[model samples]
Target: MRIKRPVKVFLLGMVAIVLLWVIHSYHFQNQQFQTDRASTYSELPVAATKVVKHAFGEVTIPVKPQRIIVLNDISLLDPVLSLGIKPIGTVSYLPQYDFLFRGVTNAEAAGIEIVGIGNQPILEKVLLLKPDVILMREYQRSLYQQLSAIAPTVVIDLPSLNYSFKENLRFIAQVLGETEKAEQVIAQYYERVKQLQQLMGERLKKIEVSVINVFTDGIIATYSDNETYNQVLQDIGIPLIPALAKQKETSLFLNIEVLNKYDADILFVMSESKNAALSFSQNPLLSTLKAAKNHRVYTVQQDRWWTYGFLGVNKLLDDLFKYLT
Candidate 1:
């Protein structure tokens, strides 16, 4: 063929453009496919019916449970709400500490009914709410038969393991078919923990933090390694005083005379009532402590620290950011 050089050049340019267009189209489609796949996985449909294994045994629960009831353990409320599930009724650790519910705005606004307190739930009140599912601690197993009769009950071994807040959150998530939400909440929590570590810099490792709760009767309570607040402190690399770390129980209570035994760079004193605070301040040993002498003693709310759960831990972290920084 007797083709001109200019014509051949024009044809080659057209071919190159066509090839470039095809490559671009393929890449765009591939990226779109990946985006769609991720979206699908993230919003995967929950099952209609799921059989969950718990302390009591295997129980089938509705995938999207409504009218949920949380009893015995108030800590369960945080995880339930974190999963975007609002319980119809929940127990309080104690009537006096119902203020703890303030941590969850949704719960407060939802006016979530209070059915009972601690392990002493009012069966009549629970049944009246007509809950689809009930979550309770394993210690409440005695009421399982009765609770299950009203709704599918899932018993979690919270007390036995002294499970961390994340562990408990995941357990509740599994029961409610919200494992994805649980993971997301946990990821966000640890991310915040990392940010805290960065903010504190060298101080994170250098500080010795003591957490204590003062009572009206001259008793002092310190957290164990298993407590949720302590777990958060551990995550941020904050060391506890040696005296507290040696305790074998979930909490160690001491008389006011031995307060000096626990020394730390900073002290967090939690008191539930005015009398407790007054008692703590009145103690002569209060002035002798290293943290007090250094003017590093800070008062914290008992409900936020003494309670184990997600919302409380987050609040505690916020306080740490304020105090440590």
Candidate 2:
């Protein structure tokens, strides 16, 4: 048997190709192990640019904010969590209510540190946490400068208790770069709204409703045309009393006698249960209103109405429909 040089060369070339392929495969596997894909839960794709406006000033949010702090309302917390981002801290103004975290895990597991109770967040403590941004309501703008000096803060004020929860959820979703989640949430809310609207519109016959807020001190406050709740009422085809329809000059205390000036078919009174129940039970004047006489007076809890965030509005609408029917 004669050994040919070309055959020897061919055998060596085949061995080299096999070894190279094995090495390439091993390297690829190692690269994948180093690049972690487990933690990314739909992070925003675009670079978070500077949002500047006359009212909000300049806010620099990382297109993807890893750490966040929530102040003011706990109601808005659920949507943030729903978007797959957790807050490092939150306010403990009301401890008992749990509507906001319906689908979230146990409070202990959620691990949301309590930053402060009622008054605005402790500026010093929040600065220490080094949050990328802070969430706040509109009235809290007084602390704008102090907060902005520490980190970017978003001041949200949706006019009217009737402010569409879906719209609100969408606004927040946009801010958090969770447009898909927002769309899904809004769609669900809309479905509920449509069903309620159909039923309430048919049975109530476009009845007028008024949302009143009362304090323990005998001061009465009713929603103005611009309030979010009013918008919710209008959405269901409910009419607002003439005076309420005309936006109030102010948002603060008014006397119960003011209710007389703006009469409506249904009256939605909001206040602390203890105080509202006491007023309705004891105050002859409050009991004299037409709605009260007919038992149309529905007392809603302030905490629930005030803090329900985006989904809260839907709950409110559902309640209204239930009351109307």
Candidate 3:
């Protein structure tokens, strides 16, 4: 059968439109690339530089680096942002929990270019950003030569020493000459923790809470006492389910049959994607959980909760106060 002339004409128009869009996008990106190449390279103005020993080696960095690039997670980005310094570029956060931290944070918000999707960096884009200092975890040492060629790259550990914000922030702040600010941030964070304790009072000791992560790969695990938001929860004085608290490993994976053993007065479920968690919850055994039956199970996006940052931790506290209180 011969196609109708009007429908065929419309289809052809749509195809032409799509083709033009693709061409336009290609040219736009190409032009931007060229523009980036033409831009002036950023350099610190002969400022006082201090030598900080890191994973790679000693790196002499600017006393105050203006165009900062964080190649790792908020472990570094948090200190920078919390200390009132904005980085020029950074890797994207998992699941984008911007909604939960809208007004309270600018962690990965406007004015910050996502130079990488996850842990992978787009070197060209990073080079174009013209960072004065490039910060990354020890795992990213392979890119040290390439990235350092663009700027003074500092290789630091993500947790540094077991996910303590004090040590991590103090070190990064010292690197940036913002140690004073780091102290203030640290004090304030703990102050909030103290406030949480006082706010909840005796009620905190009685409750048994558990935070579990449902991965897209079908791996279900609970937070160890000091992993992820567990530390924060521990600080808030919420007694995690006895079984979860006793585990020495970072991630405690519970079998389906043992769901009853990991019972909690409050269960917080977070995941990489909504579906991963939804699928996990489909198991009939979950219905056996006290929290499940009592309707104390709260599901949330594993964005800031999974991130190691002051702002993220603060947001996690907000969730606890919202849910528990």
Task: Give the top-scoring candidate (TM-score).
Answer: 1
Tens-place lDDT digits, model 1, residues 1-325: 7999999999999999999999999999999999999999989975578898888679998988888988744467767877777788887665675363534543442778878765578999999999889988777777889999999998888864457778888888877878998999899989999998998899877889888888888898886788777788888899888887787886778888888887689999988787788778877889998999999989887666655566767888889999998
TM-score of each: 0.81, 0.69, 0.78
> Which tens-of-lDDT digit does each residue in 220-248 have in candidate 3?
78766767577778777777777887888
Misplaced by over 4 Å in model 3 are 1-46, 94-108, 216-218
lDDT (C-alpha) at residue 183 in model 3: 90
Winner of 1 and 3 under TM-score: 1
lDDT of each: 0.80, 0.65, 0.77
**Which pairs clash in the backbone of model 1?**
none
Q: What is the model-wide C-alpha lDDT for candidate 3?
A: 0.77
Per-residue lDDT tens digits for candidate 2, residues 69-165, read 8775434565676566778876666444433233233452268876766635777788888888777776778888888788778765555323455
Deviation in angstroms for 17 in model 2?
A: 34
- Candidate 1: 10-residue stretch with minimal lDDT: 100-109
